[model samples]
Every structure is written in structure tokens, then in C-alpha cells.
Target: MGQNTNIRGIVQAAVAMTTVGTLTAVSATVSRYPVYGGQAVRYAVAAVILLGVARLRGPRPGPSARWEWPLLAALAATGLAGFNVCIVEGTRYTSPATIGTVVGSVPVVLAVAAPLMEGRRPAARIVAAAAVVTAGAALANGLGGGSLPGLLLALGALAGEVCFSLLALPLLPRLGAVRVSAYSAAAAVPMLLAAGLAVDGTSVLRVPTRGEVAGLGYLSLVVTAGAFIVWYDALGRIGADRAGLFAGLIPVSAVATTMVLGLRSPGMAELGGALLVGLGVIVGLRRSAERPLAVAAPADHHDPAHDEEGHQDQAHDDQHPEDRRFVAEKAADHGV
Candidate 1:
């Protein structure tokens, strides 16, 4: 059952990232549209779809603590709005490949940072695999020259990508994936709209051309709403470090998308990079007999410490939930 869950998570993460990669193709259609305003509209549409899905899925817990709200806001502000802004501005001063190569380092960041944040040592095997993934992603993207400003903006985008997953780890236990995706998408709309107003002025919300509308629809329904849920759900199942490995697929998928569109044919370098990405993901996801599960209980499992009424024992709430879950899973694995 555990192995099956991990496999499902892997599939989910791969599909989500691949879908995101196709955004490279779709983005051209909306390239002329005002970035902030277009993104605002895209996210607003996504928010509605996600909210509708969440409602149909039945009642789940909402944010109880004040701190979760801020985290969610940060997730929207930095991960969604700021990330797009960085990419748009960065490309003005640098090649897209330059920015992409910089952001390609996400696997390594997540491999090290996720474990450390949970107060565990990073797994040596996973760290090595992450390095391979990053290299593969860079090769796939190819290096390009960029101004210092573009490099800095790329770094900012990288930070945003990392925060998108890490910030949601704590919230998954309570709110699940759908609500978090919905709330963040909803929250991002206002931020993007405000930026649009300040930047694009009265022209911010003009009617989009048919092609632009189609692009926005794809970005909203598939990339934002669908991918967000799958990615977050994968994070819950596989943990961030494992799921992060799939991010390497982004560039590989982008290459494939272009090939299919007949925009470009990938050379030997791109093909080789795709092979490396597969290799890295396979190596990173291998289960170690000696290493412990990152999260103690399966995300779907009811918290043994919490009752049906959703009341938690004081002790459980005081300690970091990840640590507690780790302890619980460890005990179960050992037949304690």
C-alpha cells in the first residue's frame, strides 16, 4: 500500500510538472497581453474552478491558526504573483534559457531544504540524485548569457518555486490540497489585479483577443487549477523531497512540446538531458530500508492523537506535526 501510494504520488507530480511545462507553448498566444492583468484573470478563473471542486468534494477543515493565513498569503504573493513577475521582467534582460537554467536548481534546493526544515538530515542518496536532476535540467534548458539584473530576478523566481511547496507542507494536514490551491489562487487574484492597475493603468482589463482568451483558459483550468491540486496532493503523499525530483521534467516536457508543435527539433543535447532526468528521478525515489519515512503517518490516515471531533491533544499541537507524524509512522513500521 505504501509503495502504491508513492507510485501514485510520482505519477501525479510528473503529470503536474509536465502540464506546467506546456505553458511555454501556450504563453506565446498571450505574450502581447498585459502580464499582470492576464495573470490576474487566469488566476481568478482558476480560483473559481478550484473552489467549485472543493465544494463538491465535501467539507474539509479550514485554517484555524492565524499564522496559516499569512503563510497562504505569502504562498500566493511570492510563489504565484512574484514568480510570474520575475519571469516576465527577467526575460526582458536575459534569454529565457538563462532564467530557466537558474530555476532548474529547484530539485537540489528542495532535497536539502525540505529535510532540514523538518529537522532531519538530508538523505545522501537523494542529494546526489538532486544534483543529477539539476544538471539534466540545465542541459535541457541550455546556458545563455544574461545581465546581472536578469540573474537576480531568476534567483527570485527560484525562491518562489521553493516556497510554493515548502510553505504548504504544514497546511496539508488540516486543509488538504484542494482548499489550499483554491485559497491561494483566490488570494493571488487581488495581488495581480492591484499590480495590473498600478502598472497597466486603465487598460489593465481590456477584452482579450480570441487566441489570448484560449491561452488564458488553458493556463487557468489546466496549469493553475489542475496542476496545483495534483502537485500538492503528491507533496502530501511522497513528501516534498521526493516529489521535487519530478520538477526536472519541466524542461524535458517543454522540449517535447516544442517538438510536437514543430517549432523546434531537439538536438542530441536535449535528448541526453531527458535521459538524465529519468535516471535521476528513478534514483531519488528508491526506498531505503534503513532510512525512516519523512512523515510518520500516511497523509490519508486519521491522526491517532486527534479524535473524531477534530480535537487535538495539547502535547501533539505543541510539537511540530511532521516530527509527531514521523514518530507515529516509525512506530507502526516497527510493529510497536
Candidate 2:
């Protein structure tokens, strides 16, 4: 069951990143739209769809604590809205390759941070694999020069990307992936709209052209809504350290997307980078030779199978004491 869960997580994470990669092709169509306003609409639509799906899936709890609200807002502000804004503005001062190379280091950051955050030592195998993945991603993107401001913005984006997964961990056990996705996406809309009004003025919103509409539709429906759920679900199943390795697939998928669109063909470096990404992921996912100690959950903390939307109950039961304490305290504060 554990192996099966990991496989599902790998596949889901891969699909989610690949879907995000396809955005490179569609983003051009919406390039002329007001960045903040368009993203507001995109996330708004995604929130609605995710909420609907969550409803259909059956009733579940939401963030009940005041702190949880802020956490979700932070996730939206940093990960969703702020990340997009940084990418848009960063491109003005830097090559996309520069930003891509910087953001591509997310795996290494997560591999190290996620374990530490969970009160465990970072797995050597995963950290080494993450380095391999980052190197490959950098090679695929091709290191490029950027201004100081652009470098900073790219770093900001990297932080946002890391937070996108890590922040969701505390919420996942109770809220599940769908609710967290829905709530965070919903939280982002107002923030983006406010930014739009500030940055783009009253002209922030206008009816999009037909092509832009199509592009927004795809982004809202597939890239934002579907991918967010899948990514979060995978994170819950595999843990962030393991799931982070699949981020290397983003550049690989982007290259493949470009090839499919006949926009460009893969060069030797790109092909080699893709191989490294595959190899790194394989290495990271392998069972460690020394299994870490698993802290037993409190007897009273029984989780129904449906509560976490198919999250492996055994996995939750085996969480480190620190993890359980964190969740328990949060749940108590939330009146859950």
C-alpha cells in the first residue's frame, strides 16, 4: 500500500508539473492582458471550480482558526499572486533562463527544508538527488545573466514556489488537498484584484480577446484548478521532500511542449538535462537503506479514510511526534 501510494504520488506530481509546463505555449495569447487582473480572473475561476468539486466530493471542514486563515492568505499572496507578479516583472530585467534556473533549485530547497520542518534529519539520498535535479534543470534552462533586481525577484519566486508546498503541509491532514487548493485560490483573487487596481489603475480589467479568453480558460481550468489539486494531493501522499524532485520535470515538459508545438526542437543539452531529471527522481524515490524512526500517533486521533481524501492513514499514523503535536495544537486552536 505504501509503495502504491508513492507511485500514485509520483504520477500525480509529474502530471501536475507537466500541465504547468504547457502554460508556456498558452501564456503568449494572454500576454497583453493586465497581469494582475488576468491572474485574478484565472484564480477566481479556479476557486469556483475547485469549490464545486469539493462540494461534490462531500462535506468537509475548513480552516477554523484565525491563524489558519492568515496562513492560507500567505500561501495565496506569496505562492499564487506574488509568484506570478515576480515572474512577470522579473522578465523585464532578466532572461527567462535566469529565472528558470533560479526557480529550478526548488527541489534542493524542499528536500532539505521539508525534512527539517518535519523535525527529522534530511535524507542524504534525497538531498543528493535534489542536487542532481537542480543541476539538470539549470543545464536545461542554460545559465543566463540577470540584473540584481531580477535575481532578487527570481529568488522571491523560488521562495514562493517552496512555500506553495511547505505551507500546505500543516493544513493537509485536516483540510485535505481540495479544500486547501480551493481556499488558497479563493484567497488570491481579492489580493490580485487589489494589486490590479493599484498597478493598472481603473483600466485593470477589460474584456479579453477571443484568443486571450481561450488561454485564460485553459489556465484557470487546467493549470490552476486541476494542477493545484493534483500537486497538493501528491504532496500529501509522498511528503514534500520526495514530491519536490518531480519539479525537475517542469523544464522537461516545457521542452516537450515546445517540440510538440513545433516552436523549437530539443538541443543536446535539453535532452541530456531531461535524462538527468528522470534519473534524479528515480534516485530520490528509492527507499532509503536506513528507515527513520516513526513516531506513533496518539490513540485518540483516529482519522477516517474519507477525511483526507484517500490519504494513506498509515502514513499519518506514522508521522513524527513533532508533526503530530503541531497538527494537534493547530487543531485545538482551530476548534476542530
Candidate 3:
């Protein structure tokens, strides 16, 4: 089971890297459509596909009380809307390489933030792996010139990603990944549409070329639909911190894609970075594999050590209900 989980995590990482890597290739099609409008379409189509799949393969959508709607809306705003807009707009003022370097640090942020927010020290290996990944991403992108506005916008994208992972981790237990992803995408449609109107207005309504339409379909079906489902599935299976580390593979994959397309060959530095990313992933998996599995006992079965741990965890949750809830849910999901 542990081996299978690790393999699945690797697969998820590969999927995410491919999804982001394809973005560069699709830029020509993306340019043909209004940024916000194109994103709105991509997300809307993905939402419909996910919703349809959910209706067929899963239970009804109701998970909790009405209060969750606000959280869902927030996910839509930040994860779906803000992430896309920030990256798109940021590139206008800065190079894509700069944006890649900035956004690649998200895994490192999650590695640090996960432990602190949960009131525990992060494992040394996880931190080390994150650092290696971050270094690899920087090497892949290089320390190039970038404007202040572009840097800030790149940070916004990073922030949006942090919110997406941190916020969605807890909610996965309640709503499950498919439902949460669908709801978030559905909710973001209006926001994207509104932004599109405010920015490009009727230009968004213009007919797109065949290549552009195909690109939108790829974004909707493959990147958003396939990528998100696999991403959250990995999150649920392996936990968010480990899943986040997989993001370091983005630059590596992007470089590989570039090479495949004969756009440009990777120099020694890029090759070295790719090796580092692969090494980082291996280190991350080692950390994950080192974690002892939790075997849950029946409620009636009383073991002093387990009971004490449970009480301590409960007390921790009581002290900080919001942040600790994610830890609790993640534990429960793992049957810890």
C-alpha cells in the first residue's frame, strides 16, 4: 500500500508538471483569446465535465451546512481566478522564466508553513528537499532581470497557490477532491466573466481560430479537468505538503517539452537542474516513506499511548480550531 501511494504521488507530480509545461506550447492559442475570457471558458468547461462525472460516479454534493459556501467562493476567487490572472498578467511585465522561478518556490513555502501552522516542526528532510527543488527551479529559470510589477504579480500567483493548497487540504475530507474542484471551478466562472468584461468587453465574444479553440479544449479538458482531479487525488492520498513538492517538476518538464519541440536545447545548467529536481522528488518520497503508518483502533479499545495522543491532538484542535482542523482531517483521512 505504501509503495502504491508513493507511486501514485509520483504519477500525480508528473501530471501536474505536464499540465504546466503544456502552457508554453499553448500560448499561441491563448494569445488569440482574451486572457480572462479564455480562462473563464477553460474553467467553465472543466467545471461542467467534473460536475457531470461527479453526478455519475459519486454521491450527492451536500457535505455540510450552508457556511461552507463562503469558503467555496473564496477558493474560486483565489485558486481559480487569482492564480490564472496573476500569472497571465505578470508575464506581460516580466519574463515567463522569472514567473517560473518565483512560482516554483511554492513547495518550499508549503513545507515550512505546514508544520508551523500545525504546531509542529517540519521534518528536516522535507525542508531539505524543498530547498533543493527551489534551487533547481531557480537554476532552470536563471536569475534574470525582472520589473518590480512583474515580481509582485508573480508573488501574487504564489500567494494564490498557497491559499489553494492550504485551504483545500482540510476541505478535501469533507467535500472530497472532485466535488471541491468542481464547486470551485463553477463558482469562478462569474468572476472570470466579470473580469473579462471589465478588461476586454466584447472582444471576449469574438470567434477564435481553430487552433485557439483546440487550445481552449486542451486547457479545459486536460490541464484543468485531468490535472486538478489527479492533483487533489494525490493530495488526499499523500497529504498536501508532499503533493506540493511535486510542483518543482514544472520547470523540469517545461524544459523537456521545449527540447522535444526543438525550440531550444537545454544547456548544462538546465540539465543539472533537471537532475536536481528528480533528486528532490526522490528525497521527498524517502521522507514520505519514512513516516510510520497510523493504525486506528476502535473507539471502545483503550490504549494509553494512543488515547493520550488523541487527547493532546484534540486539545490542540480546541486551541486553534481552524488551522488544526486541516491536520485532524488529514490524519483521519489517512486512518491515523
Error in Å for residue 106 of model 2: 0.2
TM-score, every prediction: 0.88, 0.88, 0.83
Instruction: Please give, for residues 73-134, the per-residue lDDT of candidate 2 as tens digits.
Output: 89999999889888988999999999999999999999999988977678899999999999
TM-score sort, best first: 1, 2, 3
- Which prediction has the highest TM-score against the true structure? 1
Model 2: pairs clashing at backbone N, Cα or C within 3 Å: none
Q: Distance (Å) between predicted and true CA of 180, model 1?
A: 0.5
After superposition on all C-alphas, the RMSD of every candidate to the true structure, in Å, is 5.0, 5.7, 7.4
- Candidate 3 local lDDT, 1-336, one digit each (tens): 255665765687568766876777666666867888888888899999998987876454464666677888888898889988898889889998888889889879988886566456676787788888888877887645589999999999989888887777656655666788888899999998888888898776567788888989998998888887777777655556667777887777777877887888888888888778778867876733334211111121233235555676654533434436657787999999
Instruction: Give the Cα lDDT of each candidate.
Output: 0.86, 0.85, 0.75
Clashes of each: 3, 0, 0
**Whole-model lDDT, model 2:** 0.85
The CA lDDT at 127 in model 2 is 95
The runs of at least 3 residues in candidate 3 whose Cα sits more than 4 Å from the true structure, single-residue gaps closed, are 61-65, 287-290, 293-336
User: At residue 159, what lDDT does model 2 achieve?
Assistant: 91
By how many angstroms RMSD does model 2 differ from the true structure?
A: 5.7
